[model samples]
Structure formats: C-alpha cells, structure tokens
Target: MALKEVISEFRLYVCNEWISKIPSHRFRNFYYRKVMGFNIGKDCSIHMHCSFDCAKNLIIGTNSVINSRCRLDNRGTISIGENVSVSQEVIILTADHDVDAADFAGRSIGVRIDDYVWIGTRATILAGVTVGKGALIAAGAMVTKDVIPYTIVAGVPAKVIKMRREDLTYDTKYRRLFQ
Candidate 1:
C-alpha cells in the first residue's frame, strides 16, 4: 500500500477517536451544522450514531436531545421544538415509498415535533406525522397520525393512551420513574 493511504487511514482513526471523546450533549451547537446546513439551537444534545439525511432541512430547537443510534430522514424539513427528548434507536423517517405502485420509489413529507415532547425508546415517527407540543409518545410506538398536545400516545399505529397536563406534576414524575 502507498504511504499516503496509510497516513489517510491513520488520520481518519484519529478524527473518529477525537469525536468519540466529545460529550454527547454538545451536538445542539455543533459547528458541523453549518457545513451540513442544519439549524441547531442552544442547549440541545444530539448523541453519537445518529444520522441526519437532509441535514440542511433539519431544525432543532433549544434544550432538545436526539439520542444515540437514532436515524432522522430530514429530506423535507424536520422541525424539532424545545425540550424534546428522543431516546435510543428511534427512527424519524420523513419519506416513504409506495408499496402498491409498480415503479415505486419514494416520496417525502417531513416531521414536526413541537415543544416539550418526549419520544420514548425505539419509537418511530413516520412520514408526514406532526407531534404537537407537550405530547408524549411511548416506547416502541409507531406514530402514524398527528399527536395532539398534552396527550400520551402508544401502540402499533399509536393510539391515544392518556392525557398529560402542564399543571400536573405527577405525570412527569411517573414517566421519569417508570419509563
């Protein structure tokens, strides 16, 4: 092998190690966002192993965290609001292919997560879905429809499971303790 190739590989290894050592909480203000054209807000955390496809179209608000191993297909403008938390292995797909079509490829719609929303572990927000402010989607829930504000949703198609109130302090405590 060429000496140049060996040096390139070594450089990649060093860069990867350097990135890995950084705290996961700094992604909200990451400098790489400018290169990718993504608009990231203050005090947010986007952990390692998460992939943003349409980085230019992604807008992350203040105090949000997109956790480890989560994949975001942001082709069509993804808007995430303040204090939103998405746990590990969650996939937010902003596009889809039509299975019934003969020459099918795909299409895009984008996703919106409003303020104070919490998406549990491994949850999927499908194309064209809107999660309203203060909504909570449970772990492993497949959200196909719009989640209403202050509602707690869970299931395959993610039906409404319960309600959350801003004044209610116990619900936050319950989710923190239980989930």
Candidate 2:
C-alpha cells in the first residue's frame, strides 16, 4: 500500500478510537454535545465543534460530511442519507414551538435529508422537511417544506430554482427518489 493511503487509514482508526472513548455527555455538553447517544454512521466525517441534541433519533449514513457547528435537534427523527454534504453552521432543527400560541412548545416535527443531497452553508432546515435525493439546497436558504427530488432550491422559504437533469437517470447510480 502507498504511504499516504496507509497514513490516512491509520489516522482514521486513531480518531475513531479516541472519539469512541469520548464520554458522550462531556463531549456533547462542551464540544460534541452528547455524541455517544447519537448513531453516527461509518466513514462519516463530523468536523470539530458540532453539536447534536437528539442523538437517539439521529441516523447518519455512510460517507457523509457534516461541517463545523451543525446543530441537529432530532426531536422526532432526523435521517440523513449517504454521501450527503452539510456545510458549515447549517442548522437542522426538527422541533418547533406551537404557532397557535395558546400552548407554547406544544408542536414539533422531523427533518429528513435523502441521499446525495447538498445543503449549503448557514441554511436553516425547519421542522417536517424532507429534502429529496440529489437535491441541492443553496446557501442561507430557509427550507420550509419538502424539496423535490433532483431539484435545486434557494432563497428564504426555498423555492425550486432548478431541476437537475443529469446525463444518467436516477435509476442509474444515484437512485433513490426517482424510480
């Protein structure tokens, strides 16, 4: 094996071992913010200084890259798919206060990001949102509802700015939402 490849593999092992040893409460409180409770998938890249509240309700897929300081409160259920990339400071909040103010904090919802979705920097994904497979959510977007599969959305209350037209069909390699 190449030196670089071996080094990289070794580094990953060491990091994973240390991360596992980290007390979920201690890390979750200050840095990781309750990490041991969450189900972080294999080969997932979680950058430093990130926080997750609902470690119990979180299921991250393989090869996902979660950038620094992304907060996911999976009050209901937060499911992130494989090969997804969430940018820095992105907040995926699954809990919400009751809009009908008679009772506060009485309502909540879940968020789901399907496989291969790209979430831009500083975007806020509100409750009950399902970003479909291969969807591109632009930076700083306020995703209020379900994003369509293979589409690109942007702006506050994110709208469908473009639908992805790839050379191969969704059934080919990145099949999930379509087919």
Clashes of each: 0, 3
Q: Which pairs of residues have clashing backbones in candidate 2? A: 27-33, 28-33, 28-34
Please give, for residues 103-179, the per-residue lDDT of candidate 1 as tens digits.
Answer: 89788898999888989999999999999989999999999999999999999989998899865222221112111
> How does each model score on TM-score?
0.77, 0.72
lDDT of 1 at 2: 100
Off by over 4 Å in 2: 1-35, 166-179
Off by over 4 Å in 1: 1-31, 168-179
Cα misplacement distance, residue 130 of candidate 2 (Å):
0.5
Candidate 2, residues 98-150, lDDT tens digits: the string is 87797675566878998888899999999899999899999999999999998
lDDT of 1 at 123: 96
Q: Candidate 1, clashing residue pairs?
A: none
- CA lDDT for candidate 1: 0.75
TM-score, cand. 1 vs. native: 0.77
